[model samples]
Target: MSQENLELLGQSIAPGESRTVDFSMAKLYTTTKVEIPIIIERALEPGPTVLLTAGIHGDEINGVEIVRQLIARKMNKPKAGTVISIPILNIFGFLNAERAFPDGRDLNRSFPGTKTGSLASRVAYHFTKEILPKADYCMDFHTGGASRFNAAQVRIVAGDKQLLELAKVFQAPFTVYSGNIRKSFRSTCEKLGVPILLYEGGKSLESHKQIVKTGVDGVCRVLDSLGMLQDQFVKPPLTESGVLIEKSRWVRAQRSGLLHVKIKCNKLVQKGEFLATITDPYGTMRFKVLAPNDGYIINVNHAPIVHQGDAIFHISTQAGSI
Candidate 1:
């Protein structure tokens, strides 16, 4: 590829070249400049360009670690296509160890934003304008929000054959056909004709070694499937074929109290099975939490204290449930 044909941030990268670009964003209160870090790897041959982004919700660290390890291991040295790695997309939130930007807006929900919009919106605007247009396939990595632990899973929009095939190739133990949320990055990308996958695992602000490994391996597998990586670089099978889930629901707390969860993520539960118990501080009052249907536990809230109607467990029902 000629330098003129490959450009990002007004810079050209020839084939078989790799470069790191820092795109400037808003400044900190202390006048420190914050930039989004991007690593671009252009292969010697022409193929699809795959974009891998993590830390959109800053506290989700598993994807950050996965991207770090991926870059360290030279996984970006694709044999046939380009790999754009944005390890941390929300610098402000990352710095503060929070989920949203410093302005308290969710970056993931600020897609297709305006230039004169909020901080999150401006960041999203730049990403949408500069980075996303280059992607043929995209994967956004994430973890469960605060106090929740999720089993490794890939979420895709339903009825997209190409995305479903790619999700199957990822083999993340669970593939959720989730509906689109307005302004979400995935929805915006879909509207722009880019096939995107969202990988969720572990929990915010903490690294689960196994989950990180799974993410790294799954990424390589997807690249291999896309012909971006060489066969030799493809990962060994880390899991059996993932279950494609069409329906899921969160089991909520019945009453406010201290919660004791009896089940773990990835475990199968029968209908009406014992899942948890809520007890008062004095243990004078107790309420049993039971599975609403036969399904697999995909996520669990780790917080001991719960309020009435709080989501406690995320269950992916069997195919029949749909």
Candidate 2:
């Protein structure tokens, strides 16, 4: 059915009407069960249907926290339409704080999934079939997984002008324009004509104050844009504008040993600037890593030890306010 039909089915969603429902009637453990937790907030009027999702990669706790905060603050109240949240998708991986589910599948890669496929594929299929079709827009939150650290940034598919507008309104510290690869949540949503924003922040399984604050502020800004809530709650500074990054690259270690990174994430650097260096056990040999171009640090390797060719930093450069 078209989105217009869905909106027609329900109108003027009000207090006490907002409810949480387990879309998956059975737990993942059950042979015939699929578990998808959803929070539905129905406002008192007709408006756009927005979806906020996280934990596609079970280990990405920051996204989960973002969704939790959005829901807990009652950010969906008095909305013109519906704001749905699926805070956790990969239950098994989340339980263990691992990046992928138990079957060793990347949920994000298994979009538009099949029922008879692997665990991750099954979850992805369920999401596309059950959730994506209902929403007008989407925001999928993420963070660097276990091995790396990422600065807070919003990644919008390059060709999505409408989504880009919504993303800028989010007023995140960094907005990176990335071309979507096939099978990603962003790509799938795009194919369905559902504009989606991908928010990346901090590192996996760790908490950063700025990331959390920005996340809360980002969602509120979007809600304000969507007319879900009043404008007074929005953070004006973040809403002022954001830097736009066209392309990004990772600087890898040339030698294996201990690493000393001089620049933290979110710092601006010039081309050929010293980013980090690798030193041997006795410091007899040192490999200096330099920036290939002028850009800002979006992801930094937090691990002290590394091997040759391991990505140490991700930098992006683009003209205009970020």
Candidate 3:
């Protein structure tokens, strides 16, 4: 039963049968009627069900574009097992070019949602009840929010050894071992024993062609590892000494001014290295920003303007590697 053979009522797909499930809106002029477009492709052979989702945070454009390209490419050559893709989960935010919903709610933070709470909560509820339970593995795409820039990396939540192994197959430049944050989609999914890998790259409001290629390649590599795709399509590289950071800290600005940063994100920095300088009007006074420790810059604010106490940089030191 290939997906093409699936009835309008949604039937079980036979091995190698690829199909698209209409999660689209049933009505107009209402968020309640909007559908979360899903493409569920089941292979001819039985394999693990992996869910690839993007636009959890609507402002992140790289992941959204990557998912789009992936689906366009994958549809031509069907993979073995089932792959459920949600390319644009936050349609409202994506349409508005915003990070949150129209109600100013973050869908990622409202996971395993309530039916009666808020719009985001209700949407989250739909995902929890409809898609996640059917998945054996998950890959959630993300990127730096607006005003922030991040290097390509995969995040495996603490205690998820199996997810870490799958992330290893992705072979992203950086592998960050992160802990679960309360109410996060990963945290809620963890409660259900669903291991997930979080991949972050590029930045909001912009797109990187190379990063997009890497992301698509990485997703294919994971599917290959899970036996969903042909094994020889992509040969994943070995990550060279990925940093397993337990925690990261954001460096805050001391004053409001125009920020001139000297270092780049994802670069290794020595202790006391000049990171940036904040210049006031007339350039009379400048506050120098220095590295707090010897570590790598995982993320940094790209916007030149900043307020006092605003996070300007995010750094993490490898355990005992510093």
Candidate 4:
């Protein structure tokens, strides 16, 4: 049997070879080309193709660091199959240190984009047409939104036995059956029969050392599980047993005030436990926040000042034993 060359972005990467491809999305105001950078590593043996994408939200730096370290450490030197990694998907957002595109559109919500549509739509359309069809599996890395912190976790579609197994192998501390959003990357992948795991950790824009380490280790583990890596990498130490969560709810602030958090993300809490306190400037008013159910905190807003009805804490309930 003969091995085949991997073709992507109008380039061919032969077996045992790796190449970086710069896919131009559009030109900037200064006419500089805006390209989505990707690294393709093709092994000598035949196997499945896996894709790793990050920076869809632009400010998610943990995933960016994870992909950087993965490439730097030569983790892409697989024993079989191919690894396609895109460290930054929204280059414009990343350059501006923002989460959305310059047109104020969320790239994550612009999947299956059209060529003549908005900037985000065009970029998404290009990736959907050119990159996604080559993948057997996918992993989209993310973090909590601006001013929010998320504990390292994997979000998968519910009732997917295959994806659940892969998520467990990834070994993130928490797993949420978070379902899918309309026109999202995951949704497009799902429609194309590509099973993808959405891994979230830390906060946006800032790289957390632990979160980055966890993401890197998780990617390696997934590769090893897929029989892609020749040398099996050592598994990172698990700080907490993996939990499968059935549902989660975000607790919102009732009144606008300065937030005084009494607990941090990933902390298990009992029902009625004091979670935080909202206070006015000058200490004139205070309101206590409490947990509504027994569960662990998966996400929290870190911003000191928040408006009424702002999400404060996300708690995972109905955790099923894995």
TM-score per model over all chains: 0.96, 0.90, 0.90, 0.97
TM-score of 4: 0.97
The best candidate in terms of TM-score? 4
Number of residue pairs clashing in candidate 4, backbone atoms closer than 3 angstroms, sequence gap of 3 or more or interchain: 0
lDDT for predicted candidate 1 compared with the true structure: 0.88
Which residue pairs clash within candidate 2?
12-44, 13-43, 47-80, 113-125, 242-321, 242-322, 243-321, 243-322
Give the winner by lDDT: 1 or 3: 1
Q: What is the C-alpha RMSD of each candidate to the true structure, in Å?
A: 1.9, 3.2, 3.1, 1.5
Please, what are the lDDT tens digits per residue for candidate 1 over residues 1-322?
2223567888888888889899898788888988888999988888888899999998999999999998999887788878999999998888889999988999989998999999999999989998899888999999999999999989998899998888877778888989888999999999999999899999999999999988888888888887777655757575555788888999999899999999889898999999999999996999999999999999999998999999999997654221
Choose 1 or 3, whichever is better by TM-score: 1
Highest lDDT among the candidates is held by which one? 4
Off by over 4 Å in 1: 1-4, 231-234, 320-322
Model 1 clashing residue pairs (backbone)? none
lDDT of 4 by residue, 105-166 (tens): 99999998898999999999989999999999999899999889999999998989999999
lDDT at 98, model 4: 92
- Residue 150 lDDT (model 2): 85
Worst 10 residues of 3 by lDDT: 1-10
* lDDT at 308, model 3: 96
